[model samples]
Each structure stands twice: as C-alpha cells, then as structure tokens.
Target chain A: EAGVAQSPRYKIIEKRQSVAFWCNPISGHATLYWYQQILGQGPKLLIQFQNNGVVDDSQLPKDRFSAERLKGVDSTLKIQPAKLEDSAVYLCASSTGQVQETQYFGPGTRLLVL
Target chain B: AQSVTQPDIHITVSEGASLELRCNYSYGATPYLFWYVQSPGQGLQLLLKYFSGDTLVQGIKGFEAEFKRSQSSFNLRKPSVHWSDAAEYFCAVGGKTGANNLFFGTGTRLTVIP
Candidate 1:
C-alpha cells in the first residue's frame, strides 16, 4: 500500500515570506497530522485533523501558522511571514482515526528560511 | 503536563554489537508509549509501542522495548545492530484525553561503524 504523500520535498524562502506545504494521506485514513522537526530535535506536533475537523492545534502558532484539511483527505499547512527560526522539516502523517492508533508519516518538506 | 527525555544525544556502536538507547518520561498515568525511527531525508517509522499488559514489546527491524513503570522509562534495544540501523530514534508518550497528544523526546542519533 502507498504511504502518506507530500509535495515539494524541499523549499527555500526568505524571512518574512510565505510558504505552504501539502499532504495527501493514505487512502481511507481518517486522521492526519502535521509536525515540525528542528535540527537535532524530535518532531513536534503542530496540528492534528480527524476527517477535516481539527482535533488539536494548541501548539500551533495561530498568529503565523495555519492548517486545514478540507474534505477530510488532503491537508495544507501554511506559514506566513516566515522567520529564520521556522526553518525545519515539516512532516505529515496519517492514521486510522482510532484513539492511540499507529501513525504513518511522509517524507516531509524541508523548509529553509534565509 | 507530559514530557519525554532522551539523555544520550548521540551514540556510536560497531556493527553486530548490541545496542540500547535510553528514554525517560514524565506522565500522570500509564502513558501510551511508542518508539519511532527516522532515516535521513525520510519520514518517521513506527518501531514499537506499549499500551499496557506486557512490559516488553517486540517491533519491526529486530527492535524491542521494555516498559519499566518503576523506572519511568521505555528503552529501545537491538540484539545485533546493522549499519542500516543507523538513524535517529525517538521515544514518545501520548496523552490520555482530548485527541491524546503525543510528546516526543529529542531523539537519539545512532551511528553504526562497520
């Protein structure tokens, strides 16, 4: 079976510019997630979506970051006015929507803000 | 609320040597524990998890983990490591409610010397 898919495996942007990342989850998976992994650190959950509805986004930087999973399958994470600190790998994952289910991840988009 | 700690930032082991990576966690209750591996330029892959019952759990890629409640730890182990085992390993704990957020430790990077 195919795993989660993400677009633009790498991206580069200047500070204060805007960038967006996309993810297409595994077919039939009901839960999707976005995470940020800074160098030498583990991936941190940015947001989670269960069938197009947000399940948790408390850690998300609402002022500069936003995510949406419309129609419950495809998701997009956007960062406006990017900062140097925002340079990291943005990972997308999907699961069966069951509580505490195993999550499958994508290759991730490596964003470098100069 | 919940957090994880990986004491060792990096470890080097000869190929075919036994390997152990430490993981410590702080939680209010029995946590949903997991181990994930991430290769360079790749996504995170599940290695194993411990929900309850058995303290020791077997996982893919000849990996295993033992949950020690007294120690508040779940450490990943491999009897014989291969060069392919060189990657960043993460230990995570899932919250109990409200989407059950997953908290990750700053991963342990493994290098296998042939």
Candidate 2:
C-alpha cells in the first residue's frame, strides 16, 4: 500500500512571505494530521482532521497558519507572513478509524525561512 | 492537558549494544502511547504502540516498548542496536477523547558507533 504523500520536500522563503504545503493521505484513512518538527525537537501537532472536518487545531497559529481538507482525501497547510521561527519540517500523517491504529507519515516538507 | 517527556536528548553506544530510551507522560486518564523513529531525510515511522491490555508491545525492526502505568512511562528498548538504528526517536501520547490527538516529547537522538 502506498503511504502518505507530500509535495515540495524542501522549501525556502523570506521572512514575511507566504508558503503552502500539500498532503495526500493513504487511500482509505479517515484521519489526517499536520505536525511541525523544529530542529532537534519532536513533532508538535498543529492540526488534525477527521474526514474533512477539523477535529483539533488548538495549537495552530490561527493568526498566521491555516489548513483545510475540503474533500477529506487531501489537505493543504498554509503559512502567511512566515517568520524565521517558523522554519521547520512540516509532516503529514494519516490513520484508519481504529483508535489504536498506527499512523503513516509522509516525507515532510522542510521549510527554511531566511 | 496531556504531555510527553523524553529525558534524553542524545545517546551514543557501540553497535550491538543493548539500547533503552526513556519516556514519561502526564495525563488525567490512561494514555495511548507510541514510539516513532525518524531516519535522516525520511518521515516518522511507527516503531511500536501501547493501547491497553498487554503492557508489552512489539513492533517492526525488532523494536519493543513496555508501558508502565504505575510509573506513567513507556520506554523503548532493543536487545541489540544496529548502526541503522541511529536516528531520532519520539515518544507520544494520544488524548483519550476528541479525535485522539497526539502529544509528543522533544525527542531523543541516538547514535550507534560502529
């Protein structure tokens, strides 16, 4: 089976610029997630979606970050007015509905804000 | 609120040595725990997880984790470390409700000296 897929494995943008990343999850997964991993740190959940509806986004920077999974199969995370602190790897993952199911992750998009 | 803690930031050991990585979690209810490994230039891969029932869980790549409810810990271990095992490891706990969001620790970087 194919794993989660993400685009633009690497990205670089100037501070205050805008950037967007995309993810296509496993074919039948019902849950999707976005996470940020700063250098030398574990991934932090930014948002979660269950079938196109947001399940949690408490950690997302609503002021500058936005994400959507319109059709439930694909997602897009956007960051506007990016800051140097936003430089990190953005990872996308998907899982089946089973509460204990393991999550499958994508290669991630590495963003470097200069 | 739920959180995870990985006490060790980095560890180095000779190849073929036994390896242990510590993880601690804080949550009001029993947590669903997981250990994920990320190799350089790759996505996070599920090493193991503990939901309920058995405290010991086995996973791919000869990895295992033991969940200790009394200590609120889920530690990963391997009988013999391989050079390929050198990577970043993350400990995570999933919330009990509301989409089961995962809270992750800062991560541990392991180095296998050949």
Candidate 3:
C-alpha cells in the first residue's frame, strides 16, 4: 500500500517570508498529524486532525503557524513571517484512529529559512 | 506533561554484534510507547510499540524493546546488528487520553560498522 505523501521535499525561504507545506495521507486513514523535526532532534507534534476537525493543536504557534484539513483527506501547514528558528523538517503522518495503530509518515519537507 | 528521553545521541556498533539503545519517559499514567527508525532523507518508520500486557515487544527487522515500569524506561535491543540497521532511532510516548498526540525524544543515531 502507498504511504503518506508530501509535496516539495525541500524548501528555502528568507526570514519574514511565508512558506506552506502540503500532505496527502494514506487512503482510508482517519487521523492526520503535522510535526516539526529540528536537526539532531525528534519530531515535535504541531497539530492533529481527526477527519475534518482538529483534535489537538495546543503546541502550535498560533501567532505564526496555522494548519487546516478542509476535506479531511489532505492537509496544509503554513508558517508566516518565518524565522531562523523555524528552519526544520516538517513531517506529516497518518493513522487509522486506533491508539495502537502504527502511524505512517511521509518523506517530509525540509524548510531552510535564511 | 509527557516527555521522552533518549540518553545516547549516537552509537556505533560492529556488524553481528548486539545492540541496545536507552529510552526513558515521564508520565503519570499508563503510557503508549513506540520506537521509530528514520533513514537520512526519509520518513520515520515504526519499529515497535507497547500498549500493555507483555513488557517485551517484538518489531520489524529483528528489533525488540522491553518496557520497565519500575525504571520508567523502554529500551530497544537487537541480538545481532546489520549494516543496514544504521539510522536515527526515536522513542515517543502518548497518553491514554482521548487525544492521540505523541511526545518524542531527541533521537539516537545508530552507526553500524562492517
């Protein structure tokens, strides 16, 4: 079966610029997530969506970051006025909604802010 | 708050040798644990996970992990390592709460020598 898919495997932008990342989850998957993985660190959960509704986004930077899963099959994460600290790999994952189900991940978009 | 800790930033092991990586977590209730492997430029793949019942869990690619409630640790192990096993390993924890969000560790990089 095909795994989660993401667009623009790599991106580069200047500080204060805006950037967006897209994710297409596995077929029939009910849950989707966005994570930020800094170099030499693990992926940090940025937001989660169950179908078209958000499940959790407490860690998301409300001032600069936003994400949406309008139709619930695909999602997009956006960062406006990017900062140097925002230079990290953004990973997308999907699961079947069970607590024990394994989450499938995408190659991720490596964002480099200058 | 839930958190995961991988004490070793990097480990190098000779092929055919045994391998072990340490992980610890802080949570008040029973936690869902997972081990994921990420090759360079690739997405994270699930190695194994532990929900409850058996403390020892077997995973793909001859990997296994044991959860110790007393020590609050979940360490990954392999009886014999292979060159292809070289990758970045991450440990993550999720609570039993309604949300399925995960908290990940900094990660451990594994290098296998021939």
Candidate 4:
C-alpha cells in the first residue's frame, strides 16, 4: 500500500514571506495530522483533523499558521509572515481513527526561512 | 498536559553492539507510548507502541521497547545494532483526550559505527 504523500520536499522563504505545505494521506485513513520538527527536536503536533472536521489545533499558532482538510482526504498547512524560528520540517501523518492505531507519516517539507 | 523526555541528544554505538535509548513521560493518567525513527530526509516511522497489557513491545527492524509504569519510562532497545539503525529516535505519549494528539520529546540521534 502507498504511504502518506507530501509535496515540495524542501522549501526556502524569506522572513515575513508566506509558505504553504501540502499533504495527501493514505487511502481510507480517517485521521490526519500536521507536525513541526525543529532541528534536534521531535515532531510537535500542530493540528489534527478527523475527516473534514478539526479534532485539535490547540498548539497551532493562530496568528501565523493555519491548516485545512476540506474534503478529508488531503490537507494544506500555511504559514503567513514566516519567521526564522519557523524553519523546520513540517510532517504530515494519517491514521485509522483509533487511539492505538499506528500513524503513517510522509516525507516532510523542510522549510527554511531566511 | 502530557510531555515526553529523551535524555540523550546523541549516542554512538558500534555495529553488532547492543543499544538502548531512554525515554520518560509525564501525564496525569495512563498514556499510550510510542517510539518512532526518522532517517535523514525521510518521514517518521513507527518503531513500536505500548497501549495496555504487555510491558514489552517488539517492533520492526528488530527493535523493542519496554514500558515501565513505575519509572514512567519507555526505553528502546536493540539486541544487535546495524548501521541502518542510525537515525533520529523520538519518544511520544498520547492521552485519551484531545483527539489523541501525541506529545513528543527532543529526539535522540543515533550514530552507528561500522
């Protein structure tokens, strides 16, 4: 089976510029997630979507970051006015809606803000 | 709130040597624990997870982790390491609440010497 897919494996943007990352999850998966992994750190959950609805986004930076999964199969995460601190790998993952189910991840979009 | 901690930032081990990576968690209730490995320029892959019943869980790539409630620790171990095992390892904890979002630690980078 094909795994989760993401676009633009690498990205570079100037500070204060805007950037967007895309994710297409595994087939039939009901849950999707976006995470940020800074250098030398583990991935941190930025948002989660169950189908077309958001399940959690408490950690998301409301002022600069936003994400949507309109049809439940694909997702897009956007960061406006990007900062140097936002330089990180943005990872996307999907799971089968069970708390215990293992999540499948995609090759992340490595964003470097200069 | 839930959190995970990986004490080691980096570790070096010779091929065919036994390896152990430490993890600790802090949560109000019992948590679902996980270990994930990320190769350079790749996505995170599930190594193993522990939900209930078994304290020791075996995973792909000849990896295993033992969940210790008393110590609030889940350490990954490999009986015989391989050069391919060189990657970044993350420890995470998931709670029942909030869409089961995972809390992850600062990762542990493993370097295998042949």
Give candidate 1 regions above 4 Å deviation: none
In candidate 3, what are the lDDT values of residues B1-114, reduced to their tens digit?
Answer: 899999999999999999999999999898899999999999999999988899999999999999999999999999999999999999999855523777899999999999
lDDT of 2 by residue, B29-54 (tens): 87888899999999999888877899
Give the worst 10-residue stretch by lDDT in candidate 4 chain B. Answer: B94-103
Report the lDDT tens digits of candidate 2 across residue range A1-114: 899999989999999999999999999999999999999888888999999999889999999999999999999999998999999999999998676778889999999999
Structural RMSD, model 4: 1.2
lDDT of 2 at B80: 99
Candidate lDDT (C-alpha), each: 0.93, 0.92, 0.94, 0.92
DockQ of each: 0.69, 0.66, 0.68, 0.69
lDDT by residue for model 1 (A50-72), tens: 89899889889999999998899
Report the lDDT tens digits of candidate 4 across residue range A1-114.
Answer: 999999989999999999999999999999999999998778888998999899889889999999999999999999998999999999999999975788899999999999
Instruction: List the candidate numbers ranked by TM-score, top first.
Output: 1, 3, 4, 2
Off by over 4 Å in 4: none
- Which portions of model 2 show Cα errors greater than 4 Å? none
lDDT of 3 at B66: 99
Candidate 1 scores a chain A TM-score of 0.98
Model 1 chain A worst lDDT run, 10 consecutive residues: A94-103
- Order of quality (lDDT): 3, 1, 4, 2
iRMSD in angstroms, per model: 2.0, 2.1, 2.0, 2.1
True lDDT of residue B6, candidate 4? 96
The lDDT of model 3 is 0.94
